[model samples]
Target chain A: MTAAAEFISVSKRFSRRAKVRTLAGLAGQWLRGPKRGPDGLLPHEFMALQDVSFAVQPGESLGIVGPNGSGKSTILKLLFRILRPDRGQVVTKGRVGGLIELGAGFHPYLSGRENVSINGAILGMSRADIRRQYEAIVEFSGLAEFMDMPVKDYSSGMYARLAFAIAAHANPDVLLVDEVLAVGDAGFQLKCYDWMARMRTSGRAVITVSHDMYAMAASTRCLFIKSGQVKAHGDARQVIEAYLTDLSRDRHDPVLETNFIKTADGVPRAEIKSVELLDGLGRPVTSIGHGANLMLRFHYHAAEQVHSPIFALTLFHDDPRYPLNLPRHYLFHVFSGPAFADQTLKGSGTVEVLVEDVRLPVGCYRAKTYLFERDGVSPIFVQDGVARLEVDRPDWSDGRPLLEHRQRWTITSHVST
Target chain B: MSPMSITAELREVAGARGLAWMLASREVRVRYKHTVLGIGWALALPVALMLVFTFLFTRVAKVDAGGLPYPVFVFLGLVPWQLHANILSGAARCLTDQRNLVTKVYFAREALPLSVVLSALVDFAVAMTVLAALMAWYGIAPGPGLALVPVVLAVQLALATGLALVLSAANLLYRDVQYVLQVGLQVWMFASSVVYPIPRTGNLKWLAWLNPMTPILDAWRTCITGAHFGLAPEFGLAALISVVVLVAGWRWFRRMERVFGELA
Candidate 1:
């Protein structure tokens, strides 16, 4: 089968940050600036998409993942023909439905029904087709009761939901969605993902850009982009792993270790200088087990004198956007802050939160720690992103040392051989 | 795409009840929105202009009115000129006004200009009714030739719509077109037969005849007031120019459409 969308030697150039551009900013920039590229009779040009070529096959859900300002959205815009690429061609073989920023097409004064019809027509659905799907769209959007109300009155979620319903139901050959699922509540988001899965299974191609990693992993082949170039593209798992690994490298840490802490602004004043997981003899270890004795030591300093200070710690596994594991519910332990101890020397110390058996799922956990004053009168200092811990299943099967579990296989069959 | 498809799309635009209402209601609502005595301006401006033109043409210039009242003479021509001007100017910039609609979705961008033209039809209808009432009160009945008024009005509408298509597309590419059209329309207005009857006495009468609008407005006045308009030659030329302008505007728009989404 032919690919649904193909970008051939597509190069879009845009100027580097003159300033952050808003709609009003765009009006001024394009109006005053000398035009260049395309028709070279103009002057002063910038590249947005540069010499990039890629093709998306039928039934393939392609996720364009990148950090902010990486030109992921610009690719979507080009596909939608909102902005033309100066050099190369974007050949699309089918009816293209783009929800490039949901609610982008809705008029505020029009009622839901009116907007639905117009938006459907805009998506290339004929009037008869829109009429046929009108009820289905209203039902899918759950806006049947509010169909007559002006869209401006709808909340942002309602607006996005309605917009998605129209675009999805249009049954286009190629669909382009840009961060649309980010607007709705969790339930609606799940519903959208479910619909997208159906769209994939039915052989309609989908191109989506989202910061939602789970959704990206669930339904699509992923493309990782960095500064307008394709960094990685392949299986979802491999691509996501590579992307996360690459991103981890971007974090500037002098210690060459993944360390982190979470804090609530200034209230609980603590800065974790270092975090190291230690074994039974307090030796630093990179790997540990489910029932291993773990020491989470937080090194910190006091900016000002404090009467009494408390430490709050939490643990998270795998995902950076959400914290899913916590060994303690901020089990605050009080200690004398370094300020009051010695007059000549500033005070600093380490607080170790020891876990007898860390009951964490098999994954990496970044240690999150916070420190605060007890009286709640004043905030001294704060810091986040302390360090990292790696955990696994414990093995004491033959009464050998648990550390032997790192070996791939048992030695029982070797004696008979 | 076939012409049939384009026709169908235009029908879809016209048939859309909400769009129709929006086109009609917004024209009136927007015109009077913040102004005092909003809707009254619709009636007041044209009549006021007629009085000024009558004073200038009849009293100051001592021009003959061809045996009819000078106010009736100018009003007959002014109605068509005003309709054409409103439709042309409004339609030319219609696409620009709905900038949000154009970029957000892919419908026929032509709908914007068409909507503006349709909306102006409401104002035209209102003025036509007022014209009819004034003619009756003045004891002036539309001649047997009055049946041709719709055809004349249709020609003028065609001319305006064509100009609109061309200008709307042009405005997208060059921001300067709007300023150009504003000044051009003002000059074009006086050059047309809006202020005085087409001057048959002057050697320069052919200049007025060359203006497609003059024949159109003259045809309208001729149909309504039983004025001696040299119809056969003038109407023939008027029809030819209207077709050429309409087709040329459409062809230019179609050729330039690919750039509109980018530039607009």
Candidate 2:
């Protein structure tokens, strides 16, 4: 079978700092001699993609999985010819349709109906083809009532729906999808997935870049990239497992070695001395697979006799840059209750919380332990990032970890065929 | 491997002609939509400029218009000048305005500037109709020289396309190009014989001839007014300059095309 797209030892480098933001800056840089380094990059420049080779034949779906700034999107752009490789060749056989970003070619002032034709054309569809599929596009978007209105008037959801609808109808031989599936409501996302599955069955090639693990697992093949290089590539499940292990190992270094001290002010009624994340077998481990039992053990010391102390452990995803920005409820959990009601702790004691079936996805998470008085309002001692927990699940057949809900269903039938 | 020849680059653009037309029509529709004047706005600019120039030059300054009616002469020159100015200014910002598409989607980048120019042509067509009506109102009969109007318009298009390509590409690299082009266009208008006849006996005469637009604008006035329309050596020079600028600008644009996505 012919390949829809192929890259041969392709490498791309970008300046670490954009020196051409202004005309004056560009002129000044030109006056300076020999700014490039030995790698043909200017000083402080770095490689975005380094000697990466991949191919996707007809009827194959290739999923590119990587963390942010890992060159996954750069590969898609190179395949679409938006960026040229510096050291190698990229060949795309037939028409390429890209749904790389939400509403990429849409104009705000044009009507949703008009934008469909224009955006479709931009994605390589002919005017005649757009006309033929115009009704289907509008129907699929479910924006027929607002088709005549300018897109600027539509809500953001409506705009994204129309953009996705038009791109879905372009029907190119190879489809390149970025994280656009993360947009819209769950129902629309399911529709997009169904459409993609249909395309796959119809023998069209697909290259997808997504952080969603379930989507990657569903593809025919997966590539795990790190720091502009392919770390592993093969079955989606195995590659995702490798990526998760690498992520946990990278995150474990700081938390596992350092001893955190409780810094909250008060009379120091009690202090968290140590925290450990153990696996199902009770062995101290940094990483545990999803749906496996894990234990959170906190060692604490009391200054004096304390009654009804509250112990709380909150989990946080270990994204240091933009922590606590997104909805933190799922990644954060508070385990607070009456610890030893009517009992007194004079010296040191251990508090163990058994968490059954850890359903968190494959990523590094830090646990924060807090000890409070009986009121559970005022904290006596607080330890931030006390322990690191890495949840890994190689099997994504059940669906996304966050979206998966376990339930039991049964049906009784009277008639038999 | 050989470098991409100009013919090959042009053929690549031609392959995306459908997309260019769709984008151009979208621009035309969006610009005129929800407006009261509705494409009358196109003619309104040149006509308003004609009234202002006629009042200022003929009444206030008492400038000569070569014995032609000031309104007709100024209106004719303003028509093509307005077209050229609108196209250049719009095309200059075209890539910047569509930076979203430039960074996220892949298409022939020329489609953006070319579509802006094409959309301005629709406005030019509307303005031309009003100019023809004004000429009739002034009782200026058509002459055989009117056959050269297409040639004159073609030359003007060549000049506009060339400059638009160059300005749009430069504007993408440096935002200062847009501001510079705005100021430069004001000076270019005055030097192109839009208000007054070119001075026949001064150092400025050669300066006017050096501006390719001067002969093209003069040719437009001559064709409509039934004046002497013989092909002068200056006209040949203007045509040659327009083609050279067009080819050179296109080559430069293609050379810089690879970086536009990064810069935008």
Candidate 3:
């Protein structure tokens, strides 16, 4: 029962801003010690992971799930030795193969034929091993005729296929992947999963990092991370359930909270001030009963007069009853944009979109809002999963609400000969 | 915890030596794949430089080549000098140029610069053929000193690899290293006496003694043309400096490799 890879209380951090790397900047930093703030770290440094520990046993697959920047990739990088931990140790038992950022190792100018040998070497495959697997790789990629062509000319699918083929043939005892499972078409993605499953069945460990909850849940075990801390770890099903529940617990009205310090891209024409989810009485609420009246308010600040702008909102649900291949998809997308209003706004103001009765699967859901200029296609500002909405089953019902819709319907029976 | 030994550090890098050659060959193949000249560019650089310096030094500067013909003497120095210069320039951008691979994949980070050196050695091999032709045309017979040529080249590789490791690691931190390298290479070339004979007995000899490349290029010239294979104190010093530079460079690079992914 030996583990293939283990992280012993590993922690790591990265600067929030690009490092000042010139001699002059380095000298200034040396003199000033980089201007530490209230925290021990310099003003710009943020912890990527904090004393997280885990192990992947041989034949066991571990999936890491998290929101963006939750340190899932850091764990993978630590195992692969791409990024060393600042404190604690990362130990791997054997040759580690990576599908991290798939096709990132391929030379664009080299032909697919040339890239196979090179990428195989990069994955720690011996020349003899690469030669032995060369035929299998080319066959699996199904690009035999196009092997001599430069990889740059291949479509993305071809590029990924060839890259995966070589990496699969690397034949390492441990596998590391970062969202590469989401690449290619659905059929090909299934192929990648099948490959990893085959590896695991043969007693090799597999560690994958992804935002895809379905993929995470399918693994033998899952780890949920939030803001550099491991929040939950155990059975894949329970860990994913904990993450979804954490997503639903937005108690402080994080939706309308404006301290999200993302650098504005250039000077935006208009800035999103806040987005609020309100009950019919004009009071903000994170959760609402099923079929209750709901209104979405988009607040904005305009530096100057702007022509009619489009405000769009979409509600997404990862409802399990649908059993979609992907765990999440948009349930509804509504646009109050383009010709919705021909008028211009000069300053700060708010716009509202009202849904009379919200009927959705009885679970937590996410909402994404976007603001675009007159043409209405280009986004000025976007906020995703910042707002959560819940549709509870009506108290009158003793059973579950309908999965598709909550509506009255009458059907006449028909007999077919 | 104890710091890692240099042997262990280098062994970790050796684990990926095959990758180094693979990347190097990929570079060579890609560079010459569609070119009509192919590897002619490698031959072109030193021969073209020898011709330019033959005119400039023999006619305008009126410098003596210590009784040897200007083309043979200068080409001897140019062959190894080009190897040195190519590796230096390659090392300056090695980490940054392969930024994607550096960040996304895990291997010994030194492989990037070492591969750059390997590609430059391709150029060195092509340029050596022209030197062989120059020696034959001059009717210079190979002497007993000719056997020391590999030893000279070995020392030269040590020096080039050491500097490459330093430059590649430094360039990853400060982009200014690349810009500095352009001007630095010109000054370094003139200071190393690639165009003139190595300074043996003058105040300039002190400056020549200080430059690590001077002894390397001097050894190349003497070893090829059957000159005295004297193991002078200066030569010993240069070889010692090369070993120290190589050991230090490997140590420094291994220490800095932890941040390569983040910086890249």
lDDT of 1 at A96: 75
Question: In candidate 2, which residue pairs clash?
Answer: none
Strongest candidate by TM-score: 2
Candidate 3 at B92: error in angstroms? Answer: 1.6
Candidate 2 C-alpha error for residue A98, in Å: 1.8
- Model 2 residue A134 CA deviation (Å) reads 0.6
Q: lDDT of model 1 at residue B36?
A: 88
- Candidate 2 wrongly placed segments (more than 4 Å): A19-21, A253-267, A278-295, A316-327, A330-339, A353-364, A392-417, B1-8, B200-202, B229-231
Interface RMSD over true interface Cα atoms for each candidate: 6.8, 2.4, 2.4
TM-score of chain B of 2: 0.95
lDDT of each: 0.68, 0.79, 0.79
Candidate 3, B59-159: lDDT as tens digits: 88887776678898888878888899899999989889888888788877877898999999998898888877777888988778789878888888998
First chain TM-score, candidate 3: 0.66
Q: Clashing pairs in model 3?
A: none
Instruction: Please give the DockQ score of every candidate, comma-separated.
Output: 0.24, 0.61, 0.41
